[model samples]
Target: MAGLHLAQLNIGRLRYEVGDPRMAEFIDNLAFVNDLAERSPGFVWRYEDDSGSAIETRPFASDPRMAINLSVWDSVEALERFVWQTVHKRFYGRRHEWFERMDERYFVMWWVPAEHRPTVQEAVERLRHLRQHGPSDHAFGWESLPAAQLWKSARCA
Candidate 1:
């Protein structure tokens, strides 16, 4: 916790375009969620564009509907608390209504120096490493956490 921060990247395939009627609810809630994260305890940083929304930044040029979120927190516990113990959990519960099911693991987490902010390419590379090599100290998911770890409280059921 002294020198390291947790960096995470999660990519989702959207079932519909951001402006589509089907995605309206998700779109409407995006700002609120973003602001919540900004105010959440232990929040460090999040990737955003000039509009302060990451949704418009298409990381995967081939798929216009691919949405990615990259953020940093003081620890896994901080991130888990925000994700599982807040209103964000409600939207997360309804993710399937806005996002398509992904066949592969779409999330990855790794440790970074507290002062370091990860780039999109670096986050993608870590995700690729996890996909190709499975979890390790370099890249991991909730499954990689030890049973006694704080992640247990935040782990998805």
Candidate 2:
């Protein structure tokens, strides 16, 4: 660990408004999954508003239907465990029912200082970098780089 936290941003285009009956199941599970992530090992922080989840936040100003999730984890492994090993996995499996299949990259990851809390603007820039340039040290995808190398590269950035 280089005292660098992993910052991740994932955007999804909703199939319907969150309050719609069609999205009830997904909306109903938000709190449980959010609580699970907060309690999970190595969890640091997540983007939230008065509603307690960022699902209502629209990072893409042009797309009201887009929902964004941004979070920081102590390490890649910690994030992977939370997403793949917990009850959240069930929601991940059913994501297609609520979210549209995006043609472009919907997620991006980067390294930040331990104390840094990334903003939505920063996340948008990272996602843009990933979309425009593919994966690089500055912005990457789910396929991660070695922590040592990633931290070194991030520092150089």
User: How would you encode candidate 2's per-residue C-alpha lDDT over 46-130 as one tens digit per residue?
Assistant: 9997788987788778899999889999998887778767887778778889999888888888999999999999999999999
lDDT against the true structure, each candidate: 0.86, 0.84
As a TM-score, model 1 comes out at: 0.92
Candidate with top TM-score is 1
Per-candidate Cα RMSD to the true structure, in Å, reads 2.1, 5.6
List the pairs of residues colliding in candidate 2.
none
- Residue runs of model 1 more than 4 Å from their true location after superposition: 147-157
TM-score of each: 0.92, 0.90
